[model samples]
Target: MEDWKKLYENPPETGVLFYNETVMDHFRRPRNVGEIPDADGVALVGDPRCGDHIKLYIKVKDDRITELRYKVFGCAAAIATTSILSELAIGRRIEEALEITDDEVIKAAGGIPSGKAHCSLLGVVGLHYAISDYLRKKGEATSGDKR
Candidate 1:
């Protein structure tokens, strides 16, 4: 509760005009909400208790992620986190995309509400899992595989 309270007291910048606008705009108009029919890989995760579910799709070429998309179902925080993550992953090298962390996503969203901080982790986990799926399909064990 303390962390959530702190967020309420000092909301972070969400790259929007209004502080809350960041979360609202993202949730309302989430990016990459559909599927890519030819996606190389896909990852899905869900928190049944919170009813937070996210699916990420990625397309890779020459060890770089050329495309990324997502379909997320959850609270405002989770949806916004997914939106930001998809945008960041596109056109990134696979390794670079894998390096993206929950902290980075949260910070980019002007800091999610303290109560919703965990939602950011959901997005990170989804991304990692999605990348793992892509790597596995490409016959690699982990993102660290140099070959």
Candidate 2:
């Protein structure tokens, strides 16, 4: 537990200093911090021992993401990544949002502290699974991979 804390909290100063103000703001107060009552798609992803979790809600229209929201419970980077990721997904087509990777989130945030890279993984994978769920529910073919 302590090791995880160190990993999340004791990132090198030189690394975190580069994060953009927007990232920091979102990290401190993540947007869309609640569940969608009747979400068209909802996904929960995390490592239990790592104490990271993210839940995504998506509404697709014409195969595009017309609405997206999320709830995140994790470290700073995870929350920041989740906030930015939801914003990124909202106006994008479903397939396009699925293409969003951890690298892009990190880059868009002006780069996350190196050791915190896994923090973004939760949001990335959560979105992937959520979209997959949506597609599967809609009778679209999928690999049926469950992470």
Q: Can you give the TM-score per candidate against the true fold? A: 0.79, 0.79
RMSD (CA, Å), candidate 2 to true, equals 6.5
Clashing pairs in 1: 13-110
Please give the TM-score that candidate 1 achieves against the real structure. 0.79
Residue 86 miss distance in model 1 (angstroms)? 0.8
For model 1, residues 20-89, the per-residue Cα lDDT tens digits are: 6777788889887888888888889988778899888888988888888888878888989889888888
lDDT of each: 0.81, 0.82
Off by over 4 Å in 2: 1-20, 140-147
Root-mean-square deviation (CA) per prediction? 6.5, 6.5
Clashes of 2: 0
Off by over 4 Å in 1: 1-19, 140-147
